[model samples]
Each structure stands twice: as C-alpha cells, then as structure tokens.
Target: MMQLTTGERQLGAIVLIALAILGIAMAAAGRTDVLGIHGAMVLLYSLALLFLLFSSAFGPEPSPARLTRYYDDPIKVGVGLTLFWAIFGMFIGVWAAAQLAWPILNFDTSWASFGRIRPAHTSGVIFGFGGNALITTSFHVVQRTSRARLADQFSPWFVLFGFNLFCLIAVSGYFLGVTQSKEYAEAEWYADIWLVIVWVTYFVLYVRTLALRKEPHIYVANWYYMAFIIVVAILHIVNNLAVPLSFAHAKSYTIWAGVQDSMVQWWYGHNAVAFFLTAGFLAMLYYYLPKRAERPIFSYRLSILSFWGITFFYMWAGSHHLHYTALPHWVQNLGMTFSVMLLVPSWASAGNALLTLNGAWHKVRDDATLRFIMMAAFFYGLSTFEGSFLAIRPVNSLSHYTDWTVGHVHAGALGWVAMITFGSLYTLVPAIWKRERMYSAALVEVHFWLALVGTLIYVFAMWNSGIIQGLMWRTYSPDNTLVYSFLDTLLAMYPYYIARAFGGLLFLIGAIVAAYNIWMTVRAPSAAQLPLDEDLPASDRPLDGAAPTPAE
Candidate 1:
C-alpha cells in the first residue's frame, strides 16, 4: 500500500484544515447548504491529493526509466477514464435530447428539470467526456512526440483525479440548484477554486514535461493543447470572478451584472468552444490522424497557418453571439468580420486532416475507428461553415433564441466532438489493453452509422423547426401585433422534436453497443504484451499498415 511522505502529509493536513475553516466560514455566513455541496467537493479533491501524495512516497519504485515511464501510466489512466465517462456523458446527452421531445420525460423532478439536466448533459459531455479525452490524448502526443515521460507521475494523477472530482461537484450542484448562472461558467465558487488548483497543477506538469523533452521541435498537437490549457485557465478565472458569500459555499454572485455579465459570460462561453473544444480536438486530429494513417502530415506549413489564424480570429467571434445587443456596434462588427475570417483556418485544419488520408483511404474503410475520425473531419468542416453563416447579423437575428442554435451546437458536439472522442478511444483501448483487436468491428461500424444518421436527423430537423419559428415570430399580421402565439410556435416544433428524440435514441443505442464492446474487450483473455521499447515500424501496426519511409 502507498504511504505519504512528510511533505505530502503536510500538504494533506493543510488541505483538511483549509476545508474545515471554509466550512466554518460558510456556516457563520448562513450559507451552510451551499457549503455542504462545496464541502463534498473539497473532500473529493483532498482524497485525490492524498492518493497522489501516498503513491509518490511509497508506491513501488519506478524502474530505471526513460521519459516514457512517467507519462505512459498517466496516459493509460486518463484514457481509461475517458472511455469510462464517454458512455455516461453520451447517455446524459440522449436523455437531454429526449427531454426536448417530451418535456415530461424529465419526470417532473427538480433534479431532472430541463434547466438543470441541460447543464448536466453539457457539462457531462464537454467537461467530463471531452476533457478526459483531451488530457489523455494530449499526454500521449506530448510524450511520443517529445520523447519524454511526464515530469511527475503523482502530479498527473492529481490533475486528472482532481479535475474529474470538480466535474462531479459542479454537475451535482447544478441539480441541487447551486449555480452562478453563467452559461459555461456555471459552477459556483467552490468548484471554481478546486479547478484553479487542478488547472495550475496541469500547467506545471505540462511545462515541466516540456522542459525535459528530447526533441527540439515542439509537436503541433502539443502547441494546440498548450494554447487550450493556457487560454482556458485565463478565461475560466476571468469569467468566473465572483464573490462567495462564504469560503465553503458553492453559492456566489458574479461581480458583473446585467449586460456586462452577459457579455463576459458569452465571451467565455464561445471561447470555451473555440479553445477547449476546437483547439484541443484539433490537437488530437494532428497527432491521431498522422499516427493512424502512418503518414507524414499533409502540410506542416498549413498547420502553422491554421493554428495562428484560429487563435487570432476565434477570440473576436464571440461577440457575434451578441449581435444587435447592447454591445457596442464596433464590437459586433468585429465579431462578424472575424467569424467570416474564421472559416479560413477552420477549413485549413479540416483540409489537412482529409489530405493526410491521401494514401490511407483503404484504412478508413476497413477501420471503423478511422472512419469515425474521417467523418468527424468532414463534420468539422460542415459545422464551421455553418457557424460562420450563423454569426452573420441577419442570420443571428433569425436563429437567436431558437432551435437553430441548438442544432448548430449538436452538429459540433455530437458530430465533431463525440465522433473524435469515439475515434480516439477506439484507437486507444486495444493499444492500452494489449488486445489484438476490438470485440467486433462490425458493431463499431453499426455504431458509427447510427451516430452519424442520428446526428443528421436531429440537427436538420431542428434547423427547419428553428427557421420556421423565427420566420413566424418576425411576421406581422397587418398591424404591429405578433403574428403567432408562443404556443403556436411550440406546436410547430413537436414533430421536429419527435424526430430529434428518435435520432437521439439511435445515438444512444450506438453508445450502448460501444459500452458493451468495451466491456467484453476488458473481460476477454489478454493478448501477449509487447515490449515497451520495441520500435515497430508504422507498417507493422494494424491501423497504420502503410510502408514506412526512411524519414520515419
């Protein structure tokens, strides 16, 4: 069993004392209920820290190791967590989708209300599912490309465990009605504080690992992931600046109010999509595509261009969400212009991904995992183009507060983010578990089609419904009175909602099949393990069977 070192023990004791003080503070402030939720979160973080500290002190001494030893375990743990959470997160997504079709499907429970569950679904997928995937893939890419292990084993575990614990607290608190009510920044003060510590740990670990890298060339994927981690840390802190009523409590009031709050929230919200979702996933694409295809990236120059372009342009596009609002006209115009420019970089990345499959098209057909990734690239292109169009003032006027925005988000989330995550897991599981292959490739193909078709049906139906509702709402009946009653617009949405539910059901079925496949793979007899240092050519691998070049 692991045991804590003197330093580690001191850290644990400090954390406990901090929690106790925070609890007392909240109770004194008459916010005990809020403090209880946050206290639970604090306990979880403390537990994770304790595990790390003990492991560092007393776990079996690591072998005389190269850089790979440090990162490999962390990568495996992170990947395992990603796979575990994918099913749960996607399940929540299907549930939320069903609620749109039948509001009563939420069971009229406060915990399962549309408002609460929607955040739950989003947080589950985005932070839980997506976050795990990003960290796992980023760790893998960083280690392999840099030829270095992570800087420290315990630190990685701390970041992973603590972040997930924070996610748990944030999601659970939402059901309990503890929120700052910021769009993507909804977690109250306690979760925010824990996250700050976890994020700082992550930043430190990454920087330390980079410092020890063997390669002079920092891989493109690491660049994107670094940008994501850095920018998100800043964004989170800025947008979530709130004064807690007490130290232990989850409840807090945003320092900003009214339109200023709205501006800050959306700015953080949209960039969360940009940096967290787009940038991080792009990192995955950069590494996985080349690795899976067993080919050089199509154009390194294009990648550099896209990276800078996206970084510059995406920051300004958030204001487009607030077009025609109280925001200054120049800010809105800047958002519109930058959003249009965003198409260039977005497509550049997509083009790079597709072109990387230049000689690897056969693998895409045979490998269900590769197909999912390829299709994700396709959807990324489609969604970005749609996003650019939606950001236009005229388009925003029509689509705002309607199902169109919903459709757009799902197109990106389900089609792009979830698909890439699935692809990454499919690639990761067999490799990590030392399995020769998946439980059933045919089942994966079925899952792919189900998700693809389901996403299409869901997004397209909502698009049609949203456009119709928007048009009807804007139409005046001879005089200045509204043309359609709110109920009439809702009535118009029923059929589309039903279609969306059907699509969501299909997607859920796909996720269930995937979960079953993973479970069987875990249970099945293990294959002979390969030597860690064995340097097999890409052509020797199942996924990347193309001939290896001298450069490799």
Candidate 2:
C-alpha cells in the first residue's frame, strides 16, 4: 500500500474546496448562459477533485500482488488503453482519408464533416493513441533502464486515466461544436485545464521515478522523453492561454489575437509534432533498437550531439508554418534557417540507428519487429529531409495548401510514428505476457511488406498529385487569367486520392495482422523455461561493468 504525505492531503483538500466554492458561486450568479457545457464541465471537475481528495485520504493498495514480480499494472493498463485507442484512432483516420477521397463518405452529417472529424482524427491519434503509447512505453523504458520498479501503481493509473478522460472530453466536445478553433489546439479551455492537471501529474511521477533509479547512468532515451514532457507542458500552457466565456460549458477565446495568435498556435503546433512525434519516438529508437539487436550503440557522441542539436533547433521551426503569413519577415527567416539546420541532427540520429545495425542486417531479415524499427528510422530520415525542404519559402508556397503537405504529414505519422509504435509494441508484448516468442513470424513478415509497400505508394502518389496541383493552381494563362478551376485541381487529384485510399487499406490490413499476431502471442502457453540465450550478453559487451552505451 502507498501512503500520501500530509502536505499532499492538505493540497488535495484545498483543491476540492476551491472547486466547490467556484461551482457554488457560478450557480449563484444566475449566469446560466455559460452553464450549458460549462455546468457539465464543473460537475466533471468536482468529481475529479473529489476523486483526488479520496485518493489522498486513502492511498493506493495493490490487488493482492498475484504475480511473483510486480507486473507494473499501471503500465499494463496504459498499454491496453494505447492499443484500444490506436485502433479507434486509426479507424477515424482511415475514415477521414476516405472522406477526402470521396466526399459522400461523410454521409452529410455535421458531426462527421471534414472540419469536425479532422480534429477528432488528429487529437485521437496524437493524444488518444500516441499519447497512451508514449506514456506506457516511457513507464516501461524508465523502469527497465533504471532497474527500479515503478514508484506506485496508483499514480501511473491516475496519469493514464486522467489523460484518456481528457481526450474523451476533448473529442466529444469537438463533435459538439465546442472549440477554440485553433489547429491541434482545438480543445476548449476546460479540456485544456484537465490535460494540464493530468500532464503535471505525469511530469511529477516521471521525474520522481528517475530520481530513484537504481542504475548508475540515466539512459539516453530518458533525455528525449524528459525534453518532450517539459517542452510540451510549457508549450501547452502558453499556446492554450485563453479567457473562458464561462466555466460551466466548453467555451473560450484565445487571449492572443491576430498574427500573435497564429504565432503562438503554430509555435505550439509544429513543436508538438517535433517533440511529441519526432523526439519521443527517437527516444524509443535509441533504447529499443540496440536492445532488440543485442548490439552496442554505434556512436555515443553522435547521439548526444543529435539530441542537443534537435532540442535547440526544433522550437524555432514552428515559425515556418506561418511562412508568408502575417508573421514578421525576420521571424519567418529564423524559422526557415533553423528548419534547414535541423536536417543535420535529424540525419545524425538516423545514421546512428542504421549504423547500429551494421552487423544485424541478418536479424532484420527475420525479425519483423526490427524491420519496423529500421524502416521507421529510414522514414524518419526521409521525412526530416522532406520537412526541411518543405519549409523553404518557395516550396512552402507550392506545398502549403496542397495534398503534398498532407502526404508529408502522413509519411511522418504513419511511417515514422506508427511504425515505431508497432515495433515497440511487438517487442513489449512477449515480455509483458511472459511468452517465449510471437505466434507467427511469417504473419509479421507479411505485415511489414504490406505496410511498407502501402506507405510508399500512398506517399508517392500524393507527392506527384500535390506538385501538379500546386503548379496548376499557381499558373496563369497567357492572358494572365486563372489557368485552372478548383474543380479541375480536385479532379486531377482523384487518382492520387484513390491510390492513397488503397495504401491506407493495405496499412490497415497490416495493423490487423499485427493485432492478431500479438493476440496469439498473448494466448500462447508459457514456455517450460525461459530461453537461456535471452539472458546471455553479446560478445561485444561493454567492459568496466558499465551500462551499454546508447545509440543516437
């Protein structure tokens, strides 16, 4: 059982009392106009407050400790949520893609329109799916590298449950037409507040656990994850600065106006992609790649260099998204310059990952998990190069509103983020379930090929169509008139859209195969004994009894 400190209890009580007082004041003001969604929000807030108070009063008690080793139940729950939400989120993404390809797929429903559903897809994948995966894996990676059991089951559960609950509110509110209308920051003020609380708890738990690590050296993955958590918290608070219309329902306006608002939003938005999608996954690659390959990291200095370089440069690149907009010319120039500079660190990590597997190519041939990770690294390199190129003003002019941007994003999201996630999940499932091996290596191979081919086709088709659309949109006739109607551009994209749909389908099939493989592995009977080879050190194991060096 875990116990709370007196200070923690007092803090919890104070928060609950404050919430109660606020609720009563709102009710007394007769400001029912803001009470619609705000009222519901207040109730939810009160409930969360009460739950925290109760938790502080009586700390968590484990459920009998049924397993011999502490099973890291919080991580397990987080993993389960990740899988569940991944499927749901991806389904939404595929549906949205289909809507893009075929307008009628929206079924004329307001809630299902592209505007409403697009944010849903983004939030679902980024927050619901990727968020859970990152939390789960961070917990797992931290415990393993640190050689320490998690601090407590309850706090982890609180972090996971609270985050997912926030996702639920945010997504539901989007469909209900409640929004701040900022891209990626679309969630209303209440949703943002909930996420802030959940995120702070996550930061506290993560920092505390790291402080208690049993290992001598903190692994490189921890650096990336820590950067992600801290930077994101800062970005969230700053970009989400808004005055609530009322607290009873989901309504608020961003405090920053005009070009300032755009600057803040994209600063948060692009960095959200950089830190959340890129940096965190890079951390996964750093830890998992060498562990799976059973080899030493290729370059320690390179990893450190890449980590610092990326951290310094990425925060500025968000301004590139505001290129040719109301943003100042100097700011945009800085964004462009930093974005270009980013290629060096990005490729440094990519090179380190690929080089780490110099003698492990044979394993890649047979290990589906390794294949996913390796391919993910390859795409990471590809996407970063593409991102830098896209950030150029001339290129941005062409690609900004075109499907090319869409293609570029999916190349990163599906290829880099999704692939790395799948690879990590593959590595994790057996260990978590105590299985000897996956159910079928052949199915994993099939999945790898399907996803790889699908992603390639999808990205290539979009690149081709997007360039064409951009050129056509910009071209004027000899008489200096518009050369193409919007409809003509739309028609030109039909083939590419169809190709994209096919690619998405193929990827979906691969995911399904992966899910089945994971399911079978989980269901498989435990081996009579653990494999001895699994415990053996590689021939090139580090001397001096130090931890293995981390790959970039």
Candidate 3:
C-alpha cells in the first residue's frame, strides 16, 4: 500500500470494500446453496486483501529512482505463482489419469470424480499456469520493448492477482459442482463477469504502457500478446453468453441452445487453443527465444507474416472441432481448409524460431534452457501438422472423440506451451534475481529430460490406445455386427491410461523441482558483484528519450 500514493490507497480500499459488500449480498441472496459458500469465500478473499492493504499502508513511499527502471515485483511474484499452478495442475492431471486407469482411485467422492476434476485439471493448467506465465512474461517484455516502466505499477499486480482469483473461483467451482458445464468456459456467470473486469484492466494497462513507450513501433511479441488478450475476451464473452437463473444461484442457461451451443462452444474451444495457448506462447517465443540464443530473429518479415496469418486464420479454424457433427458440411470443410492453411504460418513460426538458432545450435546443446525452447518449436510444428491433418472429414472419422484428440492437444499443451514457458522462466529467473545462474543448472537439465520423456510417453501411449479404440469401433465381422463392444475398448484403455498417469507423474515431479529451484534462487543472498541486469530482450532497444519521465 505504501508503494502506491495516498489516492491509490483510498481507491484500493473503496474497491475492496465494494467487493466485500457484493460478496455479502451474494451470501444473503444464496444462503441455502453452494453459491452462499462461494459468496463467503469472496468475502474472506476481499477482507484478506483489505487487511493486507492497510497493514502495508504505513511503509515508506516508493523512491523516484524506481521510475527510472522497470516495475518487476509483480513479475517476480508471477513466476512463483506460475510454478505453483504448474505443480498443482499437473498433480490433478496425474490423479485424473490414475482414476481413468483404476476407477477405484476416485474413492467414490463426487469432487474427486474424473468428470469434475477433468475440467479442473484443464482449467488449472491452461488458465492458472499458462495465464500467469503470460501475464508475468508480458509484464517483463512490455517494459523492455516499450522502454518504460508500466504507466503505473498498480495495474500489473491488480491484473495478476485478480486473474488468479478468477482461476481459484473457476477450479474450486468445478469441485463443488458449481459449473455451467461449458468446456473451457465452464465458470458460472459471476466468475465470467469478474474475468471481464480483470481482462479489460489488463488490456488497458498494456495499451497504456505501450502508449508510454519511447519506441514508435510495437514489438512482434506485443502483437501476439495483444491478440491473446483481445481475442480471448471476445471469444469468452460471445460463447459464454448466458442468462443466470438468478444472482442468488450459480446456475445459468446459455443463450444458444442445441447445435448452436455446440458450435459456439467449440468455436471458443479450439480458438482458446489458438489465441490463449498458441499466440501468447508464441509471444514468449518471439521475445525469449532469440534473447536466449543471442541471435536476432532470422527473418523479421517472416515473423510478421506468421503473426498476421495466425490472427486471420485461427478464428475460422475453431469450427474444425465440430467436424462430423450437426455443423454443416461446408463449415467442416472450411475449417479443415483453414486448419491446413494454418500449418503454413505455424510452420513458419516454428521454422523462424529454429532458423534463428542457425549459428547458435551449440548453445542449445550446452544450455538446457535453449534446448527447452528448441524442442518446443519442434513440437509446435508437429502438433499443428497433426491438428490440420486431423480436421479432415475422413481423418476426423477416425480421430474424433478418440484418445487421438486428447493426445494431440497434449502434444501442444505439454510439449509446446509448457516447454517454451519453462525455457523462458529459466532464462528470466537468473537475470531478475541478479544471480550468476540458477541454484542448480543440473535441476534444469533434469526437468528438461523429464518433461520431454513424459510428453513423449503420454503422447505415444494415447496414440496407440486411440487408434486401437477407433479401429475396433469400426471393425465388423461378415455378419455386419461390431467386432468389439464399448466395454472391450474401455478395458483396452487401462494400460495406456496407466502409462499416461506415470508420464503425468514425471511432469509433476519436474514442476516441483522447478519450484524449489526458483525459491532457492529468490531466497539466496543477492550477488553484489553482478552488473545491473533488467534481463531485457535484445529484439528492441528504447529510443534515447524512452526512459520514464520524472512526472511518471
């Protein structure tokens, strides 16, 4: 609170008080239901924040010297939260995988059931882990690229913590049976509204920071980050449009019904993969990859082309997820076509990242951090190819609703998204903390191998299980009856499920190792001999006057 001015302190109190009042209102309205419990949670959350605010209010004001440098406290906190969510999300994923292999693992608990925690795992990893990574990395990236501290420090922390609260509400709601049952958009109406408020604040903060930049042009990474923020808000608001049963309840009816709902949901779903998973991470790649490699982008023009290609093509490609369903044949074909076209840009990006390392492959061999990025680019290419191929109607016939789809998504998620993020964090952590290097370079190498082997095992096991399951369903005797029952296919999945759980376990362990390494790095005494390192990327430098003005 002391970091902020007196006016900011008053404004903070007002917001927290309003939130607490709203929570009380929700509790009063939904006293007989789970909604009331969540309302109580909100009350506690707000009051906790309020107390922390006032408790810190007596500290001395921030020095004007801070204005000359970047605002990185939020980024530091963000990195820790990212790893925390990664460990949590991956653990849930392993548990869910085990439940699939052995149903008894659920212990007959409703909250522990696969159906509930499945969304929880997905949301936790994607929005919780991935979202925090994006925010923190972007906060770091935007400052260097723009050559200015954030317009103010308040928005960064607010956006980061606010987004995490939404994630908590979302994942917790799943366990409590409080969802509206939309796939990635599963959070109930109140949570959805809260996210809109948070997201808008993020967008405004980003743009305002950019506006303060000394550079005349926005960096390519910022372009992708901006897309992630803007498109997700659009996708979220549109597909999740719903009329709540009442403010007193968590239940709501989506405005779209039947096939329309399916179409809208999938449209949001696949593109969530595009904008949220792909674009934001690509932003990480655009900035961090070259920095770690110490090479300029191989082709700035190609990067621009890939950016525009992704922005234009990905929106329509979402319909591919609805293949072989009630969606029109034309829509399916269009989706397939666009998805294939998407590979062009996707490969362009992957190739761009790889080609940037043409002279620096030795770094990749010597540095686990660079290898993490290298493998991510390779997987990005692989997953996009698989996705485009899977969208074909004939191919979809075999892969749709099969474990193949699950495998493909993980190929992107575990392989591309998680890999690149870890690589970036490894690079970011040392610089931010003014350390010579990580607490243990060997731990990073350990994580890299574990993540890689785990991803491969998980992806390959699902591939085998999915193909067998798909083939069995289509196989028939001369009598024209099915050759295998659904139970038979279900039974066949157990081995693969076991393999998947093991792979997820490896990934979870890697996350835990990462968290410990980061904590030790943070807590270790700062190295006084090291030079001042903001750890800014070299992709862009600020103009002479880009420094924060005294008034700022």
Candidate 4:
C-alpha cells in the first residue's frame, strides 16, 4: 500500500533523519537565540514527514503503471500548497495593510508589531505564495512540453518540501526578530544556505528531465523557466554572500558594504523582479495562455526578443533606484537608460500573450479564467511602462521612498503576477485532479471581479497618496520655505491608507473564495481519474489523441 516506491521511502527517511540531526545540533547550540526556535521547527516538521512516509510503507509497492501517465502526485500536492500559501500570504498582507491604516491593530505585542509582520507578509506572499506557484507550474509545464515525466519522483518532492521548509524558517525568524536585513533576501544566512541547496537540486531536476525529452526541440516556455532558475541561482549566491556570527546564531554580516552593498543587493534585487517574478510567470503565460486559448503563440520571434531584452536590460537597471544618492551619477543614468529600453521587449512579450487570443476573444469574454490571463497581459504592458517611466531620475526623485513605488510594484505583482497564476491554476487544477471543470465557474467569475477591483483600488490609492506626499514635501510658500511638515503629509495619507486596506481586504476575500472552489473541485466525485502510478510515468497523450503540442 505504499504510495511511493521503496527507494523513495528510503530516501525520504534518510533526508528527514539528516534534517532531524541538524535540528538537534541547532537546538543545542542556539538555545538562547531564535535559532533554537527554528531548530525546533525543523526537527518537528521532519519527524512529521517521516511519520507520514512510514505509515504508508506497510502496503505493497505502487504499480509501475503510474509511469504511463505524467508524474502528477507532486504536482497535486503543489496545487494544494499553492492555494494554502495564497490564503495565508494574502491574509497576512491584508492584515499588514490594515495595520498601516490603523496603528492599533498590532495589539501592543512585540510579535504582532508592524516591523515584525511586515517582512512576514512580504516573504509570505512573494516567496511563499508566488514562489510555490512558480515551482508548481514549472513542474507541470516541463512535463507537458518535454513529453516526458519528471526525471525522478524524489527530487520533485525534495524541492517542494525543502523550499517550503526554508520559507517557514525564514518567515518564522522574522517573528523572532532575526533577519539579515536585505530587501527580498531578508532570510538569515542559514535559510539562504538551505535555499541554495534546494535550488541546485531544482536546476538539476529540470535539466535532467529536459535531457530525456521525446520532443526534438525544446519549447519557449522551458527556455524562460530555465532562464529563471539559472539567473536567480547566480543572483542569490552573489547577493547573499555573508558570514554568520556562528553556526548557532542567526545574525550575519554581508560581504558587501556601503554603496557596493547597495549596488550588489539591487543587482540581485531588480533582477529578482526580472527573473523570479517576471520570467517565471511569463513562462506560465506562454504555455497556459496558448493552451487555454487553443492557439499557437502569435509571434515566436517576439517571445524570443522579449526574453533576451529582459535578461540583458534588467541587470543594469537596478541602479536607477539609487538616483540622486551617494552612488555615482553615471551609474544612475545608465540604469535609467536601460530601464527605458526595457520597455520595447516588455511590450513585445505582453503583446505576444494578448495576440495569442486573436480568434479566442469570444472564449475570453465567456471564460473568467481566460479574462484573468488576458488582463494579466494588459497589466504586464502597463506596469513595465510605468516601471521605465518611474526609473527616470526626475521621476525617481519624486517617487522614491513614497507609496507610489509600492503602487507600481503591486501593479505588476498583484495585477500581472498573481493574476496569471490564478488564471493558470484555475485551468490546471481540474485537469490534474481529473475533473470536468472547476466546482463553480460562477465563483471564478466572482473571484476575478473581486481581484480586479481590489487591485485597482489598492494601486490607485497608493498612486494618489504618493503623488500628494511628493508634492507636499517639495512645495514652497511665496517666502521660499517649504509649506508642509512631514506630519502634515502623514495626516493627509489616512484616507488613502484606508482605501488601500479595504482593497487588500477584497483581494484576500477573493483568494478565500478560490480556495473553497478549488477544494470542492478536488472533492467532487470523478469517475475518470488518473491512476497514481510509479516513477517516470508515461502520459496518456498518445492514446487520447491529445499529443503534447509544441508549446512554442
């Protein structure tokens, strides 16, 4: 009755044991530090996983026939975890936004404070929610495009659970006041090291699977995904170079300092947005958008152009964030220039996604899921343009350190990133679960409108709030003295802050609706279900007349 192969069970037990030992050492070494808490977590979670693995070991081995279909169990768990993180992350985000509008919500508890939960919200959504979605879809997309199963069963689960473990440790540490203090790289040295291990395995898993592809030519979606993995690995290693105070302690000093640190961090940071956020999801869009629309990519050449443009232009543009600062003026100007140039390819990619729907506009009109993807493309075009414009030195002067930057980020994040993910998941969930459709198509429409309205409200509020802040800060009276105090600006922001919080709440509610819908979809009885098969499963594409279409 084992759901996994004996080899897989053995591997799971071995890995969990190693993690347990590491956890024990951590507990002993860092009893006085937050490291101890993380250690306890690692130990407990490892034990739980071990228990689950062994409990199913008493039965006969799973049939090798599973190898006949796509390796989908990991994909199934990934779908659930993705929705789980979406709910958790989005809820925390709404709470954080609410805290900003109403300072009293933190309840005077240190753990509940804004400073503590803010990073949790960021990591929870960015890494937890968005990261899981990327990993899940990558697994699904790779198998279909290659017309091959995952290279192995074990590595997929390792990457999934290991990455989640790192996320848990990173976010939990923030509640304990342990951070390396870098933007988007806030997890301390230990978590960063763990992520590196998981990511390397992920890269190998992808490359190895692609090596066994039945298709002669690799697909464009795979190209973007590979770019995401390769570039992010390089960026994470470089930006996170640091020396821990001790193996037991969570604190660490970065290898970089002053302006050099700033440059390296953004070099990692902006490209993180480029590769992790943009490239990976664009991969999702490439495959799911076309498949869902039942259309080929409009212009294969445009996809390539956008891919290269993003890869090249985004590296230098991080400097634009440092405009009018201690960093060299020339560097700032260079960042600005590349950021502007980035618009061409960004627009190209967006256009390609939209153009794929040429004859499918009627489908888009009728299907909320398709509309989600279509609007995601529209927002992608808009947000990239806004990013280039804001990167201008003069614009950055006004927008920097204000809520406008926050608004611009969500315009891409909530609109482009989350929207595409939701659209794809809606399509992917039922297919993987072997259902006819979602539990409720009507609910999808409901979630779509909620998400759209929420994003608009949230973004517009920040835009207005940020502009007002900049103008007030820069304004002068006839006597040439500044007209507004910082306190005055703060007071003016309360109403917009309320609006932002309300919008965020709406988005969170939408995620909840999605969670329930997908949950029911999985629960709904289906007579035709893929038999849970074994390692290197073959897909039924050949028999069903649904061959793996080239996802160019």
| Alpha-carbon lDDT, every model | 0.80, 0.81, 0.89, 0.90
**Candidate 4 lDDT over residue span 1-552, tens digit each:** 145798888988999999999998898898979888889999998998889888887778888888878888888888888888888888888888888889999999988899888889889888898889999999999999999999988999999999999999999998889878888999999899999999999999999999999999899999999999999999999999999998989899999999999999888889989999999999999999998899999999889888888888988899988888799989988999999999999999999998899999999999999999999999999999999999998988899999999999999989999999999999899889877788788889999999999999999999999999988999999999999999999999999999999998898999999998888778665544433342333653223222121211
lDDT of 3 at 384: 95
Pick out the ten consecutive residues of candidate 2 with the lowest summed lDDT.
543-552
RMSD per candidate (Å) reads: 6.0, 7.9, 7.0, 5.6
- Model 1 clashes, total count: 1
Q: What is the C-alpha lDDT profile of model 2 across 289-315, one tens digit per residue?
A: 998899878998899999999999999
TM-score of 1: 0.89
Pick by lDDT: 2 or 3, better one:
3
lDDT (tens digit, per residue) of candidate 1 on 11-93? 55576557556545545554458566456455555655556555565455444544335346666667667766767776777
Q: Estimate each model's TM-score.
A: 0.89, 0.86, 0.95, 0.95
| Candidate 2 global lDDT | 0.81
Model 1 misplaced regions, further than 4 Å: 1-32, 44-60, 65-70, 529-552
Go through the candidates in order and give the clash count of each.
1, 5, 0, 8
Error of 1 at 393 (Å): 0.3
Candidate 4 pairs with clashing backbones: 1-59, 1-60, 66-533, 66-534, 67-537, 67-538, 68-538, 69-538
Q: Write the per-residue lDDT of candidate 3 for residues 1-552, one digit (tens) a residue.
A: 346766677777888899899889988998977778778988999899899889987777777787888888889989988998999899999999999999999999999999999999999999999999999999999998999898986777679878998999899999998888888888999999999999999999999999999999999999999999999999999988999898898899999999889888988998999999999999999999999999999999999999999999998988888877888989988888999999999999999999999999989898888999999999999999999999888999999889999999999999999999999998899888776677777788899999999999999999999999999899999999999999999999989999999988988888888888788777654447422354545534333342222210
